[model samples]
Target: MALKKKKSKKMTSTGTDVNITSLMDVLTVLLFFLIKSATVSSLELTPPKGMKLPTAEMKEEPKEAIKIALSKDMLVVDEKTMVKLDAGRFPASYLMEDGRTIKPLKEFLVQEYQKKKDFYKDVADENVDLLPPPTLLIQADHKLPFGTLKHLLHTAAISGFADYQFVVETPGE
Candidate 1:
């Protein structure tokens, strides 16, 4: 029997490298989408110092309004210092002698109304006879006294801010 020469097989190597550039591009797009959606769904409101917001069951979304923030030590209107609380008391500069109407607050509201009216007048159509009423948003601490809130509402009504809304926190499910 003739012995056949043994044939040696050449060794061939198979590479196992993985391409991750496409996967990285997809993950980057997903991250961007999540960040954009989170910002769009969240409300932008900052409570003042020492203020804990009240919780409510209401589902209505708040509209644009002049924000009035009330904390234990200060009262801010649209980020402007309206009154400084002294020893847990409302400032005398804002309160009238009768202690019923908040004069300074009313005056500020009237000035704001005038400014908005002028702006609207310049931008509104001549055929429009009346403009929509302005809205006011009150952000009061949960521990705030009822009497203080009552006075604030009364003052706001007198200042022609009949459309008012209270800012509160909604309990999470």
Candidate 2:
């Protein structure tokens, strides 16, 4: 007697497409969490000795950045004295050829700005205009001359450090 042979069916993919919207939504939320957790939002800054800081009702802590501090006898950056002020004024020789920029401060600021730019180079978006500007955190004595800050700001702007923030003493709650 001859036995009948049975044919096996093969499995094949269907025409239905996979929906990726849910996967994309999950990825976006993870990216947001990583960005928020990785950054430092507060700074540990101490006022220069013998310097009086202005008080404020600050709602948030200062973020980390390059710091510049000015006092009567000296000018400091990152806790290092950059220059010895002559009664709260920079020396005439410290001025650059343009007669506006401070040489030492400009040099330091430019180098720092370059480093920051390079760090953000890979992080830059398609539009160069959207790149974040370099920032400076300034801590100055309340009695400092407006001219002093004005000069510093002008010099910094030339070095591409246009966005700056001030560090003031926050009063107790």
Candidate 3:
């Protein structure tokens, strides 16, 4: 009877291919996370109670901006109630001498404009024209009087917000 012994081999390094697919997948996930985190949303807009938004055929998507919502008995700015309405209208005490100026709304908008300035101050320093334009998103009851809207617009203009977007619901939704 005879027995055979196996020969020992020395371990050595060999060229190996990198798994670029897995690496790319991890990088893709990280990129998506960073992109999502870096974006700052203005606010979530849920239709206030007792308010019906008008429907429209939207041509473009709305961007991030300050929101001015007029509910049944309140005026809201970015979800914060700025003025409590009286019978769906602003209280007399909330108006200025001009009668069209919404005192509380104007004040809150001015403060918000200042905040936007500070937030984009660095950008302004780089290029004065690069600063984001002050914009407002107006959400109001469909039955609101045109006069009230006019006053709201005037107040927003005086408060330094020059651009506006009227919020609306689309058909079938």
Residue 172, candidate 1: C-alpha displacement in angstroms: 1.8
lDDT of 1 by residue, 1-173 (tens): 88998887867688889999999999999999888755343455788877899999886777778899877677789888888877556876778877867787888888888777787788884432376778898899998887677667878887778788888898765
Best by TM-score: 1
lDDT computed for candidate 3:
0.82
Each candidate structure's TM-score, on Cα atoms with residue i matched to residue i, is 0.73, 0.69, 0.68
Residue 136 displacement (Å), model 1? 1.2
lDDT of 2 at 58: 74
| Candidate 1 Cα outliers beyond 4 Å, as residue runs | 1-14, 17-43, 126-129
Evaluate residue 103 in candidate 2 and report its C-alpha lDDT on the 0 to 100 scale: 90
Better of 2 and 3 by lDDT: 3
CA lDDT of each prediction against the hidden true structure: 0.79, 0.80, 0.82
For residues 62-136, write the lDDT of model 2, one tens digit per residue.
667888888767878889998887877777888788766889999998898767666666676334456678688
Better candidate by TM-score, 2 or 3: 2
Spell out the clash pairs found in candidate 1.
Answer: none
